[model samples]
Target: MRYTLRQIEYFIATAETGSITLASERVNISQPSISTAIAHLEQELDTQLFVRRHAQGLTLTPAGKALLVEAKRLVEHAQQLYEVASEANDKIRGQLTLGCMVTLAPMIMPELSHAFTSAFPSTKVMQVVGDHDTLLQKLASAEIDVAITYDLHVPEGFDFVPLASLPPHVLVGEIHPFARLSAVTVKDIASEPLLLLDLPISREYFLAIFMQEGLTPHIAARSPHQDILRTMVANGYGYTLANVRPRSDTAMDGRKVVRVRLAGDHRPMVIGLVSPKERRKSRLIELFENHCRNRISDAYIPGMVAPVMEKRIRLD
Candidate 1:
């Protein structure tokens, strides 16, 4: 009943890894320290939580296994309590977790997280990056407090506050003929080799554009990493369809690239903040949310090419 949060954390680490040495490495503590914490947890709970074997590490006893779930829940609740506590007074000082879609992570996280932390030096923002489905799962499990993701198949009971619209664009190398055009239609690239970003939800999102046009892209390359896809396109492997335009036009290898608006009336992906519909706002979360609203907009997104309404936005 009086066990400390640290003890529970160490206990969870040990339970998860099944070995004191592994837990020690995972939690950045000494093996003996973890062992002591586990012992303390067992003594407090008045039950043997782990069944230690001679050389096989440890396994949770039935009682221990049952308690593991509660221990995890308790630890998570403790974290939420800390975030919702006295620190909420004035000087916002607590940890805030933000989940971002994988494709946007490269262009968004570093700048956004750094700016939030820099603005509120007392606060720390931990970022988790995943594809759309993974971000949705994480948000549901309360693993991340909020998410910056596209409004793609967002389920019922979650609130999505749209921040900016990122219309899909055709990505080509500087020397590619399509790069010279102000815009290109889906038919223009249907036969051209495609560099597909093969991430969940995103793949379907891109392919559906061609589907709507009753065309199938001739995919020549696929990558999950945005940088890799850009590099492939820059090397003439194939052109790609992308929405998050990184500020740099050059690929990882320094070859220049171009973004041509994918012409016609196409549905643009809207980036937004997603969270549980009824979760009360935490000051830290609210601050970060407001920061995102200010940072990303109809006209601007940090570390990304601004909207080129009249071709003023530069990817470089």
Candidate 2:
């Protein structure tokens, strides 16, 4: 071969970090060595890999971007070689890539991922957060091995393993008119100004609450951030709907909010694991999937709280 895996490794690090200096720091190598490997790669491939700016970081050319996915896969496959040897001793040791929904990441990822790694010290998890559509796209493109997400717009070729049921709840300020209520129906809040959680499938699910009741939500504002929406609700900008509420009802800005059950019947979001149906499950993937099963359920989620309800969807 004209090039070495060391060259590919340096190439991927620089491409991801966007600078030879940062890539060297990440890989614990000298910046000059990193630069030399990438330069040699460019020579061997006869392509300009990155557009280098004097002060600014490097940006991948189209060719570099196209090859990045393959480079990452190659690294993952290389890691799998260790797993093969590890299997002789019945050890689960390899890296697993997880793509999580942005909103869910803060609520669940830290405890879930950390605990899994803690359980298997030799194993590691790398997470990338995005919206519903983005996570699904990454799953399709082989960028992520598994997705910890809500069941939303899941395409035909993906498998969703339901983990927990998050029923809808309403957020209101401590002084808001709805705070004293035990529960409120869709029609009761349908006319109230809504601070919508504006995300791809999330918004659709929230709006569907009103739609199923044959009413229109009076949307006053929209935000992609959950905390922002909570803060807005705390300050009485408007009420918002959510499935996951942090254990504490206080916003980051030190404002208190209340989570009131969205009363009566409506569709709730099911949080679960998603993966390509056709893909063969790797051992690391299996370990992570099993970890999720133990850590996430209607009875408990790692770092988030759900409203108490009599009925819940159980994993069978």
| lDDT score of residue 309 within candidate 1 | 39
Q: Write the per-residue lDDT of candidate 2 for residues 163-187, one digit (tens) a residue.
A: 9888888899999999998789998
| TM-score for each candidate, following the candidate numbering | 0.82, 0.86
- Once model 2 is optimally superposed onto the true structure by TM-score, how far is the C-alpha of residue 127 displaced, in angstroms? 1.3
263-298: candidate 1 lDDT, tens digit per residue: 898888999999988877777888899999999887
lDDT (0 to 1) per candidate: 0.86, 0.86
What is the overall TM-score of model 2 with all chains considered together?
0.86
RMSD of each predicted structure: 4.1, 4.2
Give the C-alpha lDDT of model 1: 0.86
TM-score of 1: 0.82
